[model samples]
Each structure stands twice: as C-alpha cells, then as structure tokens.
Target: MRTLKKVGFSLISIILFALLSYVVLDFLVPKSNSSSSENEEIAQQQSRVFLDLVAVGDSLTEGVGDSTQRGGYVPLVADMLRTNPNVKNVQTANYGHAGDTSSQLMNLLEENEEAQADLKEANIITLTVGGNDLIRNFRQVGLNGSVEDFETTIQEYEENLNSIFSLLNQYNDEASIYIYGLYNPYHYYFAEFEGLQAVFDLWNERTVEIAENTDNVTFVEIDSLFNPSDAPTETEVESNSGDSLEDIQDTNHPYLFEDDLFHPNDSGYKVMASALREAIEKELEDTDSLLSMNR
Candidate 1:
C-alpha cells in the first residue's frame, strides 16, 4: 500500500511539472515574438518615410481618359513615389471633377470637409486647373473667345487661383504645390483660329507668374508635350482634303485619347506623371530631404 501511494504522488508531481513547464514556455514565446515584432516596426520606421499626396483640379486630375479607372497622373505619380527607396508608402487623394473650373475648385476647397482634411494632411499637392476655366469661356463665347476676352477671364482665374493658393497655404504651408500649365487642346481643332495659340500662351504665362509669386509653388509646363512635331499648320489643315480633322488627330496625336481628344490617354498621363515626379525629386533635393518632406 505504501508503495502504491508513492507511485501516485510521483505521477501527480510529474504531471504538475509538465504543466508548469508548458505555461513558462508559452509566456516566453509570446514575449520573444512581441520583441521581434517591435524591433521590426522600429526598423521599418527608421528606414522608410510615408507621404500623403493630394491632387486637385479638373479632368486631368480626375483621370477621365484613363481606362484603368485610377485617378490619372495622381496614381501614376504615387506609383513612382513608391518605387523610391526612401518612400515606404504613399497615400493619395484626388479631388478632380471633370468639368470643374478654378472657381468650382475653390468652392470645393471651401465646402468639402473631407478634402479640407486631406489638404491639411498633405505633404505634396498637384494642381491641374486653368484648362477647364479656359474651355468653359470658349464654349460660352464660341470662336469669339479671343485673347481680349481671355484677359478678363484670366484675371478672374488668377483671383480664384490666388484664393486657392491662400487656402492651400492655410491648410498646410509646408506642402509643395505643383500646378500644371495649360495646353491648347483647341490648337488642332481650331487650327484656323489665329489668336488661339496666343490665348493659351497668355494663360500659361499668367499661371507661371502666379506660381512664381507664391511660396513653395512650382509651375509644371505641359503645353509643349501635346504639340506633336507632325502637327500640320493652318495651310495643311485647309489643304488636307484626303483626311478629315478626326483622321488627322487620330494619326498625329497619339498621346490624346481617341474618345474625346481633350484629355490625355495612358501615355500622356505617364508623361505628366514623369514630369511631376521630376519636379518632386528636384524639390526634395533642393530642400535636402528625402523623396517627400515628412511634415
């Protein structure tokens, strides 16, 4: 009987020891995993920076012509930024309405709470305005939209843009604002219109002036990119009886979307993205920061 009792006690003790050992190992393993996870997070934070990029303006920013449904150059730019070794992640917000003009964008800036919040958090801003403003004026007045007509329109546009810049500065003064210059989408269709090119030039010039005067504002020129080397002159358009304007456009403007010839296709957006990326890289170098200014 005494022998039996000893055996029972020994078995109970062995079971208890096993349970205790299991408990200790479970606690230690979790602690080890937690420490490793924490170390990894710290390392990631040290090695990479995150950026919030906000793109605001018209159809160009909205990605109207892109079949992929991604917001045009905005996503392309974000993708490029992601490839940078220093950039860990990029959060992008696109507030591009197809028919929105500068004034409309101002209204959106004033009214939209979510956009306001994103703007406040933005490390960089890409703006594509003035094009719709010009387009709207031309539509309202027809071919009568001359340089003189555009002067008044441009003054209003400048006022609205200044308000926009002021609002953007107020939202996040540290953000670098990159605004695109106007390209004459009408130059091909209205090849006979004498003052059309001059109007686009004036608009772009005023836009450059505005950007120059604003703090941390950079003007990105895209007008020249759309002008194809094979584009015909006024005489060619008038003489080319073999091909229609649509055919000529199809042949000449490969970067333009076939559906509406106004907005850019995928390749065009790529070029714009490339231009934007170059500007951002240059800014980063100038400021002596990483790919994006961590604000």
Candidate 2:
C-alpha cells in the first residue's frame, strides 16, 4: 500500500509540474510579443515626419473631371500621406486654376500672397502645366502643324518653367518639386498624324530635361499609364471593343479621359496620385538612407 501511494504521488507531482510550466510559458510568450509590437510602433512613430503639400497647375490639378469632385490628386495624395503611421500630419494648399497656362501660373505665383506663403511653407510642391499651352496650339492649327512651329512657344514655356522653379527655390529651397509630364489625349484620334506624336514626345522630353536641370525637381511620367502600348492605330482605337470614343473615355483602358476626352476622371486622378505617392516615398527613402549613412 505504501509503495502504491508513493507511485501515485510521483505521478501527480509530474503532472502538476508540467501544467505549471505550460501556464508560465503561455503568459511570458504573449508579454514578449506585446512588448516587441509596442517597440515597433514606437519606432515607426519616431521615424515619421510631417508633410506640407502645395499643388499648383491647370484644370487637371483643380480636379475638374473627377466625378467625386474631391480636389483631384491633391486630396488623394493627402490621404495617402496620412495613411503612413509615421506621418504625424499633412497640410495641403491647392492653387490649381482651370485653363491656366504656364505664364498664367507664374503670374499667380508672383501676385498671389496666399500662394507664395504656401510655397514658402511647403515641404513638397506639385505642378501640372504646359498642357493647355500645347492644346491651344493644337486647337488652332490641328495636326497639320509641325514641331518646328512650336519652337518659339516651347522656348517661352521653358523660360516660364525655369522662372517657376527659381521662384519655388527662392521661397523654399528644401521643398521637393514634382512636375507632371503631359500625356497626349488625342494620340488615338491623331494616330495617323505622326507629327502629333513627335510634338508631344518633344514636349515631354523638354519637360524632363527642365526637371533634371533644376534642384529638387522630379518629373512624374504619366504618359505610359495612359498609352500603355504603342499609340493604337485610328482603326484599332475606333474599334476598341466596339465602344465609341465617348463610351471609352472613362473605360479604364486606351482612354482614361473623362467624357470630355481630355481631363482625367476620378480613376485617372487616382493613378496620378499613386505615381506621385511612389515618387514621394522614394525621395523620402533616399533621404533617410543618406541620413543613416551620415549617422
């Protein structure tokens, strides 16, 4: 009887010890995970930096064709910036005027105190100009015009762009400027007009060159997002799934334009916002990496 009692006691002791160990491990493991998560959150918060955005440009920047009417890419970008756990706050000022040319925008920048103040305080600036400039010429002469015809106009636009950059730098040299390149809305319509493509390509190339030459300037290329493959032939575009130009204007393919077949719809604006966001994130990453290396 004593031997049996001893055996029973040993078994009970082993079971109790095992249970106690499991209970202790369960409690400690969760605490360790919680502590690790808290540390990560704290580190992320510490790494976050505040952003101030200033948007200036033409009708596109003004959010003209967006059915949501939510201030186009401006609000979208602000929302994205807010999504970052690290971004403590995002302040935005938009001076996007409908039908404003580059010269007109420059005038506004020089004359408007509010815009100048915004630029001075901005950590990032976005521009969408030069489209109306070319569009006006196209409307006047149609595809019959040659690239050489716009030389003077292009030169003047370049000068205005330089002045715009100079003014922005003067207001805040540290602010990163993102300039959107022009996308040919009429590419499908004027596919046969080879000069049209040449002119648009030349304009984009010049815009890129200008951005590269300027400090803290990034040219956001949106042309490809609209024209995914090569410029579709007129027949191909016309026969695009049997949809009319008006029907396909907002159809998410071949035509990202609004009903007007010019301005971007809400979906199109989102794409623009995405591109801008990516560029901003990349710039921030590069800056962080440089700082870390220095440290």
TM-scores, each model vs. reference: 0.78, 0.80
TM-score of model number 1: 0.78
Q: Candidate 1: list runs displaced more than 4 Å.
A: 1-48, 228-241, 246-252, 287-292
Q: List the residue pairs that clash in candidate 2.
A: none
* lDDT, model 2, position 185: 76
RMSD to true structure for each model, in Å: 8.5, 7.2
Cα lDDT, all candidates: 0.84, 0.83
RMSD of 1: 8.5
lDDT per residue, candidate 1, 240-291, as tens digits?
A: 7576655565464566787887889998899899989888777655535553
TM-score, candidate number 2: 0.80
Put down candidate 2 lDDT per residue, 1-295, tens digits, no spaces: 9999999999999999999999999887756778889998897767777788899999989988887887899999889978865567788988999999999999998999989998988788999999989988888777769999888778989999999999889888878899999987766565667788788889999999999999889999998887666656555856767877566554434445535767887878988999999888787677563233222
In angstroms, the error of model 2 at 69 is 1.3
